[model samples]
Target: MTPELTRDCQTVADRLRATGHRLVLAESCTCGLLAASIAAVPGVSQHFCGSAVTYREQTKVQWLEVDPDLLSRHSAVSAPVTDQMARAVMRRTDEATVSLAVTGHLGPDAPAELDGRVYLAVCVRSGGPGASRDGRDDPYVVHAHALRLHEQLRVQRQIESAREAWQFLVRVALADI
Candidate 1:
């Protein structure tokens, strides 16, 4: 991991620990690097749930049970698909209070339309309507964002996207009421 990404994970780990929230990671393009970085944080085992590296569409369907039609329509690296992944992982894990799902195309040989596009989502289970005061719905709300980066080497772009994914999750986890 890059120094910035390591620092980002450390910050995320600290904030999640402070909030007494467990985190689940569903990784697509970044493989498992983001999860590994967070796991490197000391005391992470307390708040860190396991991760699913659903690198392939088949794995995403098999592991997270994402709808094949959804993937076919929006592709795997899309807001709708990633949001589904985040919510699905959160639903599957009793240990996790929130989940982060990431999917993207980092280039090298990606489809023309998907090149350099990354999607990230964060989901929380607060239980009850109007529980969240941060302008989001209660229970199973997936806040998703898409970013387009300069086309770079696949690994290099994946690293950058992973950093953003971690930072975004931390921000949501630390949001004020």
Candidate 2:
């Protein structure tokens, strides 16, 4: 792993540990690089719940429950899909208090408009009064952003995306929630 990626993972790991938050992920385009990066951090298992690598539309639909209509409307790499992925991943893992989802088109064969574009979403569970229909106290606060990668090589793009994802996770973990 690159030094920058290691540092990013360390920062995210530190923040999650400080906050007592367990993280889970749903990934595509970058595949499982984000999870792998975090896994490199020592004692990461204490804060990481695991990841769902939903690289295929069928898997995204069946595993993360991403809406087929949303996929048809906005494509798999869109912000809406990542938003759903972030929230749904947390639902799948009872131990996770935070979820991160990333999707992108980083390839030579990607559509011109979508090439090098990535979307990321982070969801944090918080307690609030009457936050759910069943009167449960837990509610989620979600944040989503887009990234444009400048790397020309696919492998470089994946590495850069994973590094960027770790940085995003640090920000989300440190945020007031």
lDDT of each structure? Answer: 0.85, 0.87
Could you tell me which 10 consecutive residues in candidate 1 have the lowest summed lDDT? 128-137
Off by over 4 Å in 2: 128-138, 175-177
Q: In model 2, how large is the Cα lDDT of residue 152?
A: 97
Per-candidate TM equals 0.90, 0.92
Residue 64 shift from truth in candidate 2, angstroms:
0.6
Q: Give the TM-score of candidate 1.
A: 0.90
Model 1 Cα lDDT, one tens digit per residue, 125-152:
7742224335354467667889997847
Candidate 2, lDDT over the whole model:
0.87
